[model samples]
Structure formats: C-alpha cells, structure tokens
Target: MPATLPRLSVGETVRVAVGVLAPMLAQGVIIRRPGVVSLADSLDTNRHACRILGDLRERYGAGPVLLRLPVRELAVVLDPDDVATLLDGSPRPFTPANREKVTALRHFEPMGVLISGEERRALRRPWNEDVLDHRESLHRLHDHIVAVVAEELEGLLPSDAPVLTWDRFTPVFWRIVRRVVLGDAARDDEAITDLMVALRAQANWAFLRPRSTRRLRELGRRLRTYVADADPQSIAGVVARTPGVPGTAELGQIPQWLFAFDAAGIATYRALALLTGHPAAMAEVRQEDLPTHRGLRPLARATVLESLRLWPTTLTILRDGVEETHWSGGTAAPGTGFAIISTFFHRDRSRLPWADEFEPAIWDDGRAEISRALVPFSAGPAQCPGRTLVLDVTSELLAGIVSQFDVAAAPPVRIRSERAMPRTLAHNRLRFHLARRAAG
Candidate 1:
C-alpha cells in the first residue's frame, strides 16, 4: 500500500507541486502529466494526448490506475466501483460547491433549485417532461430537423462526390439544435448569436487557463454585463417562469450558468459531429443504422459517452475530501483537492468493451448495464439536470441527419484556435448527399 499523499491547498502553485509529485507516485503512467487531463496551458492537445493514453488503456486494464496528462496535475481514481461510490453515495460526500476549481459555472445560475438541490429536483422532471417526457414531440422535432438537413445538404453539395467535415456539418446541425431548443422563431435572432459568441469566447479563455479562476470570474462579469445589456428572457420563460431559477441574491450567478447552457450547445454537439463523422463510425451509421432512426437516442447517448470518455470537455471531476480519506490504499487530508480525469476514466475501453468500435449497438438496450465510469454529463446530485433533454436532442438530430442525407466527410473543420488550448472550429463542416429514405 502506498503512503498517504500530502494535503494540499487549492491555490495554483500548490497544484503544480502536486503535478510534479504525481508522476513519481503514479510511476510511468499517463496520468502523471497534467497535460493528459487538463484543457489548459497546452495547444488544446488534450484530444491527441488522450489518444496516446487511449493506446495505453487499450493495453492496460481501464481500472483504478494512475495516468499522466499533458498539463501538470495529479490524478487519483479508484476504478469503477469506487467511482460509483463517489457518484452515487449518500450525501454524495464530494459536493460540487466543495470544489470551485471544477464545477462548471456557465450553464445555468448556481442559484435557485440548482444550488439549493431542491430546485434541481423540481426543475428536472418538468424540463425532461417538455423535452424527453413527450416522445412524440422528440420524434416530430427529429423529423423536422432531418428534413431540414436534407434541404441544407442539397444546397451545399454539388451533384458530385464530396467529403463532409466538421466545418460544414456542425453549423447545419447547430441550426437544428437551436430550432429544437428555442423553436424556429428564435433560431436566427442576433441576440442569440451574440450571446453564444460571448459564451464561446469565455470558454476558449477557460480552456487556455483552467487555473485562472480570476480570469473566469472576470469572464463571468462580462457575461453578466451582456445579459444585463440584452435583457434577455428565457424561451422557457415564455412557457413557464424559471420558478426555481436563481433568486435576486443569486442573480450575480445567472450569467455563469447561462454561459454553460450556451457552451454545451456547441461544445458537446461539436464532439457529436467529430465522433459521428469519424470514418469508421460514419460508414456504419450511414449504411446500416440510417434506415432505422429507432436507435437515435441510444446511439447518440453512446456517442457522447464515448467522446466524453475520450475527450472530456470538463476534463476532470474535482472533489474536496470530507475527511481524511483512503483511496486505492492512499490517503489525503480533508479539504485536499481530488481530481479524476473523465478522459482517462471514459476511455478505459475495457469499461465499455466495444468502445474502439463506435458501434452504437452496445447502448441500444436500455437494460444493458455499463460500468459507472461514464459520466460525460457528470453524476450524483450535481449531475447535469438536463441530461435527458440534451441526450434526446443530440440523438434525434444525428439520427435525423443520417436517415435523411448521405453525409460525406469534407475538409477538416475550421476553428478559432486558442494559444495553448485546442481551437474551437470556425465551423463544423460536412458535404452532403441526400439519402432516399422511405417516409417515416
């Protein structure tokens, strides 16, 4: 058994020191380098970095083990069993509020039911009700998007063979997502565009400097200013008041969560584009699964799970120890920051067994049990409240596209590069050939 690791504070320098020591203790593992797990201070190389680790997990058991990432941070994981304990345990021992370093603040205000926990529960049912609870609604929305995709592809594709890439694919899909979320009326509004642009810019900055809490805070303030200036109202607000939305005391937090909402719209969806279009995965779906949009939800969920496993957008899950803790025979003082890379945890293909194949079939049966390692949308009480809604949206959209059009790989998607972090593609481009599908 290894000795107890030292207790460290939450500051930057201390975090770096942890990075240095982690490698020695973790041995020649991939998690040793912070770059392997961090989305900051590198050339957005974490994707490629995880690919390297993917090579390792392909060899090693994807069980509780140490790894080295490109950035400089220490990681400790207790395999899938331990992960379940962390995620599904009572009181969830490790709460999001405990670790400001890792909690995503850009989606919805941390106020109201989200922060209170009660509001989170209340909002969860309704949001899913409006989105997922109504299966017919999801199908109708999916069919609409699929039809639009066929039309868009017709406009974009020449009457010749073309390669579809992220640049062409993502924008068309983004529009589809917007229509689903806000309805067609809100799709082309400049206000939405400006809001998304600002949110993306802030995420780009966060990716470049994960430890710059102050910078993120400033970005939050700027976002608040944007909202204040725009005086935006929620589309849901049109449907119902955000009863559990943040209170006046928590009004300051609205922009941060709002930013997260916008960020997920693109970041997660872009990942969807990349995964679905990967040559191997694309061929199967286009040829085989395209006929039946039946598995769209399961397939899309599997896709996001795989992508999150490989290129975790949040990168790491941060936890503050409730007490002197023991993990994998090592201990940390209470309050010490404990981070586990979802990138490593998710890619441990052994967990998914069929991970390398990209066959969405593995997730088709709702009854098929999966290892607890998959947490793209996160887990426990603080788990993404909108998980069902997002999954429904992405799955239906992908299914709709594949069922309607013969999407071909185009040029590599173009993105706006952040200096150290990976660039956000200028667009998710793809060339398209219309598919001849029987009426649904």
Candidate 2:
C-alpha cells in the first residue's frame, strides 16, 4: 500500500498561509495593487515564501504537503516530478479550472478557457491556439506587431527627458497592447483598459467580495464592440472570424488575452531591468540586426525568458485533482487542490547552479529544457496557448528598445550583475535611463 501524505500542523499551515499564500494575495493575484506592490517589494515577499516552502520541503521530504484549511483539502507540491504530473495531467486528473481560480477569473473572464469545463474548453482552446498561432514562434500578425512596437516606442527617449519611469513607459506599452489585441483604432482606448483594471481588482478578492456586475457587463459590451469592428490586423478580428456555438465564449477569451498582456508588460519592463544590469546580455542584444530580423531574435527572446525565470509574473500555478491520484508519498483524494509555488523551483539553489544569477544562456543551452520546474509559461496540456505570441511581442519590443537607446536602471532601483539577482523585482517602481544612439 502507498504511504499516506504528510499533513502540515495547524501552526505550520498558518505559517504557510502567511509566508507563502498571503504574499501572493498582497502582490495582487489578479491586478497588482500599487501601494501593496511597493510594500511587498520593500519586504521581499518572494524570498520569504521561498524560505517558508523550503523548510517545509526539508521536513516533509518532497511533499504534496496537505494543508489544514477549513472545508477544503489542499496540498503544496514540492517535488519537480509532481509538478510535471500536475501540469501534464491537466483538465483531467488535474484540472486548471480549480475553485479559487474559477472564483477569481469569473470576475473578468467568466468563460475563459482557463476556468471552462471540458466541452467548452475543447472549443475555446483550439480557437485561441489558431488565432494566436500557438505552434509558431513568429505570429501571423508579426509584421503588424513589430510596426506597432516601433511606432509606440518612438518617443520614449526624448531629448528633454532621458529618464524612463514606469509612469512614462506604461501608456506607451498599453497603446501597443491595444493596437495589437484590438487594432490601431483602439490605440488610445484607455477606457477599455480601465474597465479591465477595475474588474480584475475585484477578482483579486475572489469570493470574499461581491461581483461588480455593472463593471463586468460594461467591459463585455466594450469588448464586443471591438469584435464587431473586426479590424483584420488584430486578435479581436480573428475572434470575430472564428465560428463558434452559442456558449463558446468567443468574446470571453479576448479579455484573458488583454489581461495576460498586462503581465507581459510587467515582464517586458523587468527584462529591461535585467538588460540594464547585465551589460554582457545587453551587448548580445545590440549585436542582433533587429531591424532586418523577421523572426524572434534568439538573444532577445532568451533575455525575456531569463527575466521570467528570475521573477515570474504569475505568482502561483494552481490546479485541482479531479479524481483520486497516487504520488510517491501517498494518494490524494478527489477535489484536492494543488499549489505550485513556481519561485521555489525556479530559484532552488540545490538543483540549479545558476538559480539566483542572471543567466540567459540556460535557455539557449539544453539546461532549461531538461528541467520541468522552469515553467515561465507553464507546461503540458493546460500551458498558456498564447506563449509564442507573447514571446514574439515582448522580444520584439526588447529588441526595438535596445536598438535605439542605451538603457540603465535609474536611482533607487539598482541591479548589480556581480551580485545575485533579487527575488522580487518591483516593476512599478522600476525606472530606466535611456540615451539615443548616435547615427552611424
């Protein structure tokens, strides 16, 4: 018979909640709250979480350590193989549409593929993949996206202001997002993004707070209008073209794309931070002929991947077991929720020699591919469908930025390459100094 899974003591559970779970909530699981983010950064929340989870792993010995939460069976996965199992058996033995996720995402994307039932997921997933060009690194709308990046990023380095703060860069980033996802017509549609922000803020509360029906409806109506226009160059246009049954939630999926782009924006900024610190990596980025390179630039893509590895935007990857499952430690009953704290694996020093360093070569080399734990976009069947498209857009944006200006992190946000990278990078507080390159 298989051994029973170890259960965390009540006190241990509370510590896990405070040390690991609470930080994720505080950091804003849905839309990041600025004040809380500043606090979290000062506190270095992720590092605390790593220590808490690491101690638990040492005690439990590669746990799916059961937490003592009321009215729910939950476990925190520690082993890399189990992480693989949980992700690989997605929407089956383990479903991505777990309770907390459903409760949260319902606020912004009620019918998104992430929280959909099998039938609806089957339809929506393929539609998302097709539209996003899931299999290809360079999206079908690659040229348009590159053009959007080039245009929006043009004035970022003005002669009067060489400083690039988050405030300075955010609007430019959003304009690119709007144009890519909703077309050039919606480039200035701050109203739609505002609606999304409001709803996602509600989502951060999950089931504790009441749903903002009025805001959600308004967001839906606005998204539908964009879909109706179906500008051929945008993802919304692809959604409009894709045929679906009544409940496919065609418009529903679009919100997630927009939402995911918000995290992508954070990652993009963090990538700039990483490049700012590591002159060697930035030098490699500068070497690439970005203007003529049509496909994803290898160095630029790897740098973005490294940024994600160092500080993953998605705090936790949660899944629920749909049926009874046996693990090396023991068996988990059906409906058992599993939490994968990605930072633990990504920065686990024992397994990864370069865990805490700014290393992009791991991605290009065979190292990152061998590890199941380095899931920047997740793995297996339930992995993000838009991974390729996101990488394409972000890498292009990074390449575009570096091609024009020399970047260095501004005061109060220091990234020293000689030292180990910080566990949590506060993208909001991040600022850069950009100087225009002399014409050759």
Candidate 3:
C-alpha cells in the first residue's frame, strides 16, 4: 500500500500561506496590482517563498504535502517528476480548472478553455490552437505583426526623450496589443481595455468578491464588434473566420487572449530589464542582423524565455484532480487542488545549476527543453495555447528596440551580471535609457 501524503504542521502551513500564497494573491492573481508589485519587489517575496518551499522539501522529502486549509485540501508539489505527472495528466486525472482559478477567471472568461468542462474544452482548445498557430514558431500573421511592431515602436522612440519608463511604455504597448488581437481600427480602443482591467480587478478577489455582469457584458459587446469587423489581418479576424461548434464559446476565449497579452507585456518589459543588465547577452542580440533576420530570432526568443523563467508572471500554476490518483507518497482523492509554486522549481539552487543566473543559452542548447520543471509556458495538453504567439511578438519587439537604441537600465533598477539575478523584478519601477544608434 502507498504511504499517506505528508501533512504540513499548522505553523509550517501558516508560513506557506504567508510566504507563498499571500504574496501571489496580493500581487493580483488576475490583473497585476502595481502597488503590490512594488512592495513584493522591495520585500523579495519570491526569494522568501523559495526558501520556505526549500525547507519544506528537505523535511518532507519531495512532498505533494497535504495542506488542510479551512475550505479544502491542497497538495503542494515539490518534486520535478510529480510536476511532470500533474502537467502531463492534464484534463483527465488532472484539470487546470481548479476552484480558485474558475472562481477568478469566471468574472472575465466564464467559458474559457482553461475552466471549461471536458466537452466544451474539446471544441474550444482546437479552435484556440488553430487560430493561435500553436505549431508554428512564427505565426501565420507574422508579417502583419512585424509591421505592427515596427509602426507602434516608431512612436515610442522619440529623439527628444532619452528615457523610457513603464508608464510611458504601456499605452504604446496596449496599442500594439489592440492592433494585433483586434485590428488596426481598435488601436485607439482604450475603453475596451479599461473595461477588461476593471473586470480583472474584481477577478483578483475571486470568491471573496461578486462578479460584475454589467461590465463583463460591456466588454463582450466591444469584443464582438471587433470580431464581426473581421479585419482579416488580426487574431480577431482568424477567430471570426474559423468555424466553431455549438459550445465553443468563441467570444469568451478572446478575453483570455487579451488577459494573457497583458502578462506578455510584463514579460517583455522584464526581458528589456534582463538585456539592459547583461551586456554580454545584449551584445549577442545585437550580433543578429536584426534588420534582415526573419525567422525565430533564437537569441531574442531565449532572452524572453529567460525573463519568464526568472520572474514567472503566472506565479502559481494550479491543477485540480478530477479522480483519485496515486502518487509515490499516497493517493489524492478526487477534487484535490494541487499547487505548483513555480518560483521554487525555477530557482531552486540544488536542482538547476544556473537557477540564479540569467543564462539565455540554456534555451538554445536544449537544456531548457530537457528540464520538465522549467515550465515558463507550462507543459502538457493544458499548456498555454498562446505560447508561440507571445514569444514571437516579444522577441520581435525586443529585436526592434535593440536595433534602434543602445539600451541601459535607468536609475533605481540595477541588474548586474556578476551578481545573481534578483528573485523579483518590479517591471512597474523599471526604466530604460535609450540612446539612438549611429547610422551604418
């Protein structure tokens, strides 16, 4: 018979709650809270959480440690193999639609693939994959996206301004988002994004807060308008053109794309910080004949991946067991929620040799692929469908920025290569000083 799953002591449970769970919630599970981000960065919350998880692992021996919270049972996965097991068994024994996730996402994307039932997921997932170009490194709309990037970026880089702050970068970033997902016509549609932001703010509260149906309806109407327009050059167009089944929730899925792109923006900004801090890596990116480089842009893509590894935007990856599943330790009953504290796996010194460093080459050398634990975009059937699109857009955006300017980290945000990378990077506080590149 299998052994019973190890249980965390009450005190240890409290430490996990405060050190691990609290920060994720405070940082905003759905939409980021800028103020909380600043605080988390100052406190180095990821570092603290990693330390706590490490201690738990050492004591419990790679536990899916059972935590008996007041409401339900949660297993904190510690081992890489178990992480693989959880992710690989997705939508069957394990489902991404955990209670907390459903509670939060329902406010904005009630019929989204992430939280959908098995029947609904079958239809929605395929539609999402096809429209997103899941198998392709460069999307079908790659040229259009590249053109959008080049056009939007031209406005971002001004001769007079030597510095770029997050505040200054955001509006331009959203314009790119609007153009890419909706259409060129939606480029100035800030009100649609505002409604999303408002709904997401409520999502962060999850079960604690009530859903705002009025605002959700408003956001839906706006998205449907863009979809109906079917610009033929945007993701909305692809969605509009694609044939859908009865329960596909086509409109519902688009919000998830918009929500996800917001995180991609954070990752992109953080990647800029990583490049500014690491001159060697930046130099490698500069070596690429970026003007003519068309395909994957491997080095630039790796930089974005490294940025994601260092500071995972998803924070906590949750899965719920739909049926009884036996593990090395014991069997988890149906409806058990499993939480993977992503930072612990991404930065654990004992397991990953370069955990604390910014090493983009790991991605190119196949090290990142070999590691089941380094899930920047997650793994298995339920992994993010937008992974490729996000990477393609971000890498292209990076190439565009570096090709035009000599980038450096502005004051208050210092990323030094000699030292270990910070456990938390506050993208909100990050700024880049860009000097115009000399004519060839």
Candidate 4:
C-alpha cells in the first residue's frame, strides 16, 4: 500500500514532477509501482473493462471515484457535468497530469492544447475554421463520405449471409475516408498504413518502453514526410500552416502532433466501425424518417454518443489548473493536472434512462436525454474541433452502408495485439458477406 497523505487542506498542492512521482491515493500518496503499466496494460479492447467500471461506478455512487489499477493511480470517473466542469473553460480547468504525461510521451507536440490552459482556446478555433466553420464544405465532406460508403457497401450485396467482420469493415471504412479526404494520394500509399502501425506500436508501449519513444519520433517524421509528399498543396500543408491563433501550431512538435492523431484517430475509427458494423445498430437506418429525407438517421447522434461513450479514444482529457479551484468536494491547486474520464462517466447506467440497453428511443424524444450525459467529443473551449466533421461524416457513411449492404456480425478471430487503442484487428481480416438491401 502507498503511504497515505492526510486529507489535503485547501491551498495545498499535490506536487508531482519529473523523476518524482506521487499518486493521489484516496488515503494518500505512494511511490508509483514498478511495471506500473506495461504495453499490454495499455487499453486495446475495452468492452469488458468498461462494463466492469460501469458496475463499480454504480456501486460507488457514479461520479469521481478513483481506481487503483495495480498502481497508485489517479483517474476521475466522470459524468456530463463533470465533463463540463473539466472541459468548459479555455485550456480545460480540471485536466489531469499523469494522463498528460502519457499524452506528451506519445506526441512531443503541444496537442495538449486540447487540455493545456491558454492553448486550448487557440487550438480549437482553427480546427473549427478549417473543418466546421463553413457549412458547405463540411456538408460536401459528408457527401463524399456517403458516396464512398455507398460504393463500397454496394459491392457487398446479393449475398445470403448476414454477418460483418469488424476487422474487414474497419479497414475499408478508413481506406475510403483516407482516399476521399486525402485524395488519391493515399490510394496506393503503403506509408499511411505504416504510419498507423508504427504509431500504434509506440502507443502500446506507453510507459513500459520509453525506449520506443525515439522510434515513435522517427515514425512521426516519416509520417509527416509522407503526408507532405502526398499533397504538398493540401492536407500536409494545411496542417503545417500556423492557425494564426497563438500557440495553435507548436510546429516544432510535429512528430508528437502526428503521433497524437495516430493514437486518437485509430481508436475513434474502430469505435465507429463496431457501432456501424453491428446488425442491430444498422437496423435504425431502415426507418422512414431518415436525416437525408430519404434514408434513416434514427440513431445518428445516439450512435455517435454511444460508441464514443463505450470506447472513448482517450481515457481522459487533462488540464493544468490555472487557479485554485474547488469542484464537487475536490480542490484543484493551481498547476495541478485534472483528468476527466468521459468513458467512465458516460457508462453510469443510473444517470441514464435504460442506460444498460442499446435502445435509441430514449434519446429520440428530440430533447436528447443522452445529451445531458454526453461528452464523447467533449465540451468547452477544448471540445474537439473535428467532432462535427466526424459525426456528420460517420453518420452519412453509416447511412450509405445500411442503405446499400446487408451488413451483419461475423465470427471473431484471433489477433496478436489487444492493447492497441481503437483496438484495431491484429489480423485485419474482418470478413463480411455483402448483400444489397431492399431499399437499394
């Protein structure tokens, strides 16, 4: 057991620095354990773990309970209001430090702006300007996503089988989006895959293989080169461009920035595939009142929320405390890191109606009950800029898939890596027998 610190008085700071690690035990601080978290310990397939956490939240009263995962660890099991509290202000106020260490280790870049005070506001604006600012471009992007999905799913049809392999479906979905968004440059480019693979390997290492840190940096460079080479005029250039907003582009941190996306994007893509790849989830698409006025949008927002809730890309969003703060019985001294877990919070079945079920009807009342607890893309100044684009595009792509193909679940197969976030298939062989839907 770690040493216990007496209950912290207001104004006392939980000081943690490099080479000096102290965990905030419910009781007190302890020296962090050796092998604290290995590559294997890094999250890959989170389904069962998440369920267990949910169970614990219910037993522990459902908000802000910390866990000791074989180490004196700090984790905030959160809800929407907690999420709002943590994420609401610029440079999110309640962001945690340990998670930030992990994040910084992966990407040398200041992508921490997502949680870093001051940078949070600046970083978010450009993302909005480029991806979400213009309605037309954003909609066009969604249409492109829809078109590609239609083409791919259309080829899955006229079959008798009703099973979908998340493995296969995920790659196809990513490939289509990569092609559409990055253009034909990525079509034959093996480097994109290499970039993803290498980055995943690094993220899997976490604290276990600090040696892998250098390798990850190298991979990031290679990836940046590839992207730059792919379309000097577009994708890479835009990312390289300073967002005019101060501190938005800590470009010197390119390698880290790229890796951040690698870790976050892969998980997000996997979660999306799992939700859309399921038969029951897609059933909503057959409904009469679709978002496009022709196809179904039944669980569009619900699906996005649930998937993100179930398998949040990042375990928590970290913020550096700018000023002394008090929230829900906890005091955050200035300079402390605040970690908020939307994943744990979103799964609080007690806070949600029919929370254990997959029914979308509960949120479809138009008031969106789920929104009350939702924070998949987060909220506040650091709320994800790519969020709108992701939702719009994913929904459109899902609509196209259900509209064109008879997607269904497939038998699971063995894979080597389980620690990869977004938990991509090790074999990458998710098989699906495609059949044309009647509507098509």
Candidate 5:
C-alpha cells in the first residue's frame, strides 16, 4: 500500500534473519517463528546486522531497510529525522503494543504505561509527571541499595578469590533489584525471582518446549500479590498513589519499573566497569565532591550516560503505524510497524557529534543535541517519566560501587552471553576483576 525501502539482499536477509531476529523468536514467547521480525542480540546478531546496515546505508543513502519475510514485514529506519517522526508525539497516534512485549510484559503488566497512542499516553502521564516529586523517598531508596551493595560485596569474592563481574555481580544486582522492588519483605524474593527465571527459561526454550502462558501469568500474579502486602512505602506504593494509571491494585503493573531492572543492573555495573577501565574517567568520578543527585558531575554522570549509549538495554523500540503516513522517504499504511533504533541514531554521524565514542562531557553540559539523539529512556511524549529516578539511582550506584571496589574486567573468566552492546557484559563472556579500595 505504501512505498518500500530498498529490498534487503538475499544474503543480508539470511544474515538479518539468523543474526538479528532468530534469537528473539527462539525465546519462550514466540510459539511459531513469524516470517519476518527482526530483533538483534547485540553480540551475536546485531553486530553482523549493524555492519551490514552500515554498509547498506552508505550504499542506499541513509533511509531505511525493509526486512522482507513472506508472513511478516519489518522496516528498520536508521535516519534520525525519520526516527524523530516516529517517536515524537503526533496526531496520528502510533501504538507500541507488539508481539514481543505482549509475550514478555503481559505477565507482569497486562498493559502498563509503556504502550502507545493517546489513551495509554494519558494513562502514563499522570504518574510519570509526579514520580520525581518523591525525591526524598528516592534518597532513601539509594541508601538502601548502597547498603545492600556494601554488604553483598563483602561475601561475594571469597576473601581474595578472583572474580569476573558477570559471575559475581549478576546475583548481587538481582538482590538489589529484589530489595528495591520488594522492599522490606525481600527475605523470600528469590522464590519470586525464580518464577521470572523459569519463565525466561521457557522463553529461550520456546522452540523445543510446549509453552504455557497461563503458568507464566500465574507466576506474575503471585509475585504481585506478594508485594501488595509488603512495605507500604515502596515504589509500588508510589505507583498506587499516582493520580492516573492502571491503578495500583495490580502489583504487576506497578513493578513494571523493575522490568528494566536487568538493563539497569547491567548499565550501572558497566558504568563501574567503564570508569575503572578508563583511569582518567575513574579519576574524574573519584573527584566527584558534589552529592550524587546533582548530575554527579564530570565522570559519574558521564559514565552512566556513556555506558548506556554503548550498551543500551532498550536497543529498539517499535511503533505500529495506525494510519497511512509518510516517513523517511517512504510511506506507511495502518498496521505497518516501524522501529526507532537507539544505536542507529545515537551512533549516527549526522545526529551525534561524538557518534561511537565515550565522552561524558556530552552529558556534562546537558547538551540538547545529545538529548535529541541518545534515547536510552526514549523521547517526546513517549519518553520515560522515571528518567530522573533512574539517572539518580544509577549515578548513586556507580558512585557507591566505585567508592568501595575498583571494578575492572577480569580476564580469563568464563561467562554467559556475549553481546554486541555493553549491557550483556555481565552475562557470561566478560567479567571484571575488582580490587577493594582502601579508605582515605
């Protein structure tokens, strides 16, 4: 019904299929592999596709790449101008409800504020607009996490045992997440997390195993029910009191903030790894005399921002074209799904002056261009409301971790997932060798 970008080469399609799309389909949610869907695992698939797309863009002049499959169709738009059109608020009201999110998030948040269009947007705004007003509570939250990290770091390394970050920090980060999400009643949080673990295992085994969405839904239900009865002042409480939302009755909906916990954990730890890896940066962070909240000047904020750019958790966010529209030299009819890829714009030479380099100073001055380009939390009306909370928490975590341990890559360590971006660094392939820092 609309114009198409240059068709993907046969070789490139296969590469895109295998590298960028298969891994996601192989997860528990995808019962039958669709003809076309492209979500890349940074290390395994996205790297290859990024290389291919980069070449294709240079050849085709920076528009979009249409991944053609008989049963499905996905258009990967790389141009920043086009991306802005997709993400920023528009009258047409594009929807973000996609299969992948339905599979993963429905269990936790049936329709949390993450979806698109005006109704959902209105649903999300009230809470997001006010999430930051509770800064005093966030300070307490930071103190709680820092205390956890301080205590957890002690027993993790086994006296002088060498540790890879992926191995050592993963559990620690999850524990902190549990505490944050579950609050005072985190004593039995592992049993709850076990449900998520099993669900993900099924997601990865979607290809071989008979799936059970009912069970996963039940698991999420249980976790929420558990949290509902926990501390009254938790993040869930904040979600409950918010003016407009899906209502706090569904604990699953409120803890949607924790859904990004994996990404947040990896990013925060990566900040530590990055800072430790870059001595000048580490020295800059060490010199942060300002309180952690006020942007944690120079290095801390830079490391968090830079690390996110390098290995963002939100690699690609999609929107379904609700009506026929023009975008990035092409046309989209209703139901056409387009992706706003962070790496494409963040690393694009046109939008970002830094492109693929780590310069904390980009964040140091609060550059408007960088704000427009780097979309780890997304932008415009769809932009995450929890930006301040996340940044503050992440900065504090980075500041807190580095304050205690000198985190660095631990060589010769066996790890989990090897990913393109930095988010998966803690999975398996890489690790950090941390040496405790003595007090001044």
Candidate 6:
C-alpha cells in the first residue's frame, strides 16, 4: 500500500473512486504466486482507467491519487491546470504510451502518429493539415449524413421499435466519415462497413490482441491498395500521398482518422439528446440559417459545446512525465505518469458556477476563456485538428434532422450518470423518436 496522506476531505472521494474502479479489475496473475494480482489488471483499458480518474476528480479536487501496486506506482491527476501543463509540453515531458497503441496497433500501424513522439507527430502533419484546409469540402457531406440519420429516424425507429443510441449512431456516424473522407463510393460499401465494425469491436480489447487484428491488418492492406491512386482531394488521397518519415510504415496515420469516427458520433448524439431535452434550444437551432459553422451560430454551437462539456468524448488522457514538471503549485517527479480527467473539471462547480447545468450563454459574450477550458478534443500540440470539421458536420446534420421531423424521447428518455467517465458509456439507449413535421 502507498503511504497514506493526512485525512483530507479528498480522502473520501478517493475511496469512492477506488470502489468505482473495482469492477474493472481483470484477473491479474503473477509468475511465482499463482493468483497474485498484476498491474495489468489495474486498468481494464485506458478509457476504463480514465473513468476511474474522473471519479477521483469528482470525489477529490484537482489533485493526485496515488496507487501503489506490488512493485510499481501510479498517479492519476484530475486537475485541468495540470492537464494544460502536461499537454502543452508534449512529446518530451509528456508522452502518449498506452497499451492499445504501443502493443496491439503495432502490427498494423507501427508508426502510428496517434500516440507517437514529436517526430511522428510532425510526419503525420500532412494528413491532419489537409483536413483542416479542406474541411469545407468535407462539410458538404452533411446532406448525406442527414439523409442517413433521417432514414434511420424515419424508416428504422418509430413508435413500434427503438434502437440503442450506441448501436444506432456508431455505424451511421462511421459511414458518414467514410463517405466524406474516402469517397461517395464508401457510403454504401458493405466491405468497408464490415471492416469498420470489426475494428470498432477491436477498439475495446485491442491491447489483448483480439480477433480484430485480422481486420485491422486487412484495413491496412486495403488502404495500401485502394488509396494508392486516390483523388488528391479525398481523405484517403491525402493519407496515401503523405510522405512517410524514415522507418515508418506506409499506412501509419490511418488509424488516427478512423478512430475519430467513434468520438465524433458520441458527442453528436449527446448534442442531439440535449437538444431534445431542451426544446427551446432545438427550436433555436432549427431557426438559424447558418451556412458554415466556423464559429457556429451561438445557440447551435453552445448546444454542441455544452454537450461536450457534459460528456467529453475523451474520458481521460494519459501522459508520462519525462522531466520534472511543475503546475498548480506542485512538482511531479520525472518518470511519474498522470491521467487527466478533464470532465471532472468541466463539471466542477468550484471552477464554473453552472458546471452542472447546460447553459449556452456561458459560451457567449467575452467568455472564450471558459469555453477554452472545455477541451473535449484535448489540449496542446496533439489536440484534435479535425474538431472544426466534426462540429460543422454535427451542426448541419442536426439542422437537417430538425428540418425533417420533430425528434424526442418517445416514452420519455432517462439519462443516468453514476459512471467514472461520461459520453462513451451513454446511459440512454432507446433513443430519439421522430414524428414527421406537419409540413413546414
């Protein structure tokens, strides 16, 4: 056990947080002692670990939680200020070295820029920079996504049947991304969808090297073949044409684009649900004739940003301290690793007065500082470059949905929030019912 700290009020929160993390304890094993627990069992996955960290933040203020495994030590930090410090000093003092990317994804994307150091980050720049430049072109795919969502809402789910939000949105969302990035042909490609489905499943136990590796390898092969001569404007084209740094695999950066589909869908669905929960907000969104969402019309943007605040796609981000770092009046030793649960700070009343409330007004006027702190895309050099495009696509798709029909929880939806992390473990399943508008 680690040395106990003086009984601060945060102690209770730490206890609760640890209790919450119990279910995820995988059956760890030791080589000498038959059934001894290992650090492998300490974290079910990075996402699961972050959920626990979020709990720590809620239970304790923005501080560190010390966990002393048999031979190793771990610290989970929940402070946003620390997060800024950690991420701002990326690739050196703070680095992304997780079980999933370093282990399972190695075979497929050995040089994956997603969790790479500064060099790989720069090598992968073209793909992301291209997306940033051509976001408008990608935004044009909003109509197709709306059509896809509309069809799901109108044709699939009705008074008689309802679909789980996770089940419903993931395929549609990924499909939209495929259509926009790959090409219009990908919109209806079953092969691509099947591959994506397998990969999505792989995302959970990827560190364990599940059956999904076959699929991931298959995806890498497909990208290598199909993307070789892709249109320069298409996402696949940019990825294919991107010059790989020395000693990196050809298709290294594809996973970064592919994984984003999952996060984007989660945030967008929550935004829709928030809109449904607040009819006035939905109405305001519908009335706005916003062309592009560079900075979305306040109400629509707020709904999205507010939803992100409530349910950030990334539950926690892990960074290893390579050098002694100082932040929020403390020093973390070099080699100490920390996971920041930004959701905790986003919801902390001490930081934002209306932390528990969904208020778009906070994002308005001159409060970009508060909005700046709400980092669902994360912070610093590795922050998601594709955020603006995702938001634009979300705003337009929501507008299209409202234009077609009035959507709501059919028998009244209920959202539960007792989890370590938010968003991904969405509480509402039988989601959004639609009634065809009485002719606008």
Q: Number of backbone collisions per candidate, in order?
A: 55, 0, 0, 26, 11, 0
* Winner on TM-score (1 vs 6): 6
Better of 1 and 4 by lDDT: 4
The TM-scores, one per candidate, come to 0.59, 0.97, 0.97, 0.65, 0.80, 0.75
User: What's the candidate order when arranged by decreasing lDDT?
Assistant: 3, 2, 5, 6, 4, 1
Candidate 2: clashing pairs of residues: none
Q: Which stretches of candidate 5 lie over 4 Å from their true place?
A: 1-12, 23-46, 90-92, 116-121, 128-152, 203-227, 240-250, 292-298, 349-353, 366-368, 412-427
Q: Report the alpha-carbon TM-score of model 4 versus the true structure.
A: 0.65
Which candidate leads the pack in TM-score?
3
What lDDT tens digits, residue by residue, belong to model 1 across residues 71-117? 43234553666666566642345544433432333322334233333
For residues 1-440, could you state the per-residue lDDT of candidate 2 as single tens digits? 66667888999999999988998898799999888888888899889999998898888887599999998999999988889989999889899999999999999899899999988888888888888888886888888888899898886976788999888888888999999999888999999999998889889999988888899889889888888987899888877787777677788888899999988988898999888888888888978875576576888998889888999988899999998899877999899999999999999997999999988889878899888889999999988999988998999899889888988888886588998999887888998889888866
Tens-digit lDDT track for model 6 on 341-385? 555557665566677666777767655354445676776776776
Per-residue alpha-carbon lDDT of candidate 4 for residues 362-392, written as tens digits (9 for 90 to 100): 5467434445546665565555655544555
Model 4 gets an lDDT of: 0.45
Give Cα distance to truth, residue 52, candidate 4, Å.
Answer: 7.8
Q: What root-mean-square deviation over C-alphas does model 2 reach?
A: 1.5
CA lDDT of 14 in candidate 2? 98
lDDT of each: 0.44, 0.88, 0.89, 0.45, 0.58, 0.57
The local lDDT score (0 to 100) that residue 337 gets in candidate 1 is 47
The segments of candidate 3 whose C-alpha lies over 4 angstroms from its true place after superposition are 1-3, 290-294
**Deviation from truth (RMSD, Å), model 3:** 1.4
Best candidate according to lDDT: 3
State the weakest 10-residue window (summed lDDT) of model 3.
Answer: 286-295
Per residue, candidate 5 scores C-alpha lDDT tens digits across 1-440 of: 66755677778778767755554345223121222212222354434545655666677676667777675557777666666677784425566665455445554455566643356656555555464433232433455545555565565466767564455766766676666556656644676666665555455453345556677567666666655575544555554444453442344344456655656766776676666556676766767776654433446766787777766557677776667667555665566667665655666655556655566777658763545657777776666656665666677667766677776666643221232233223233456766778989
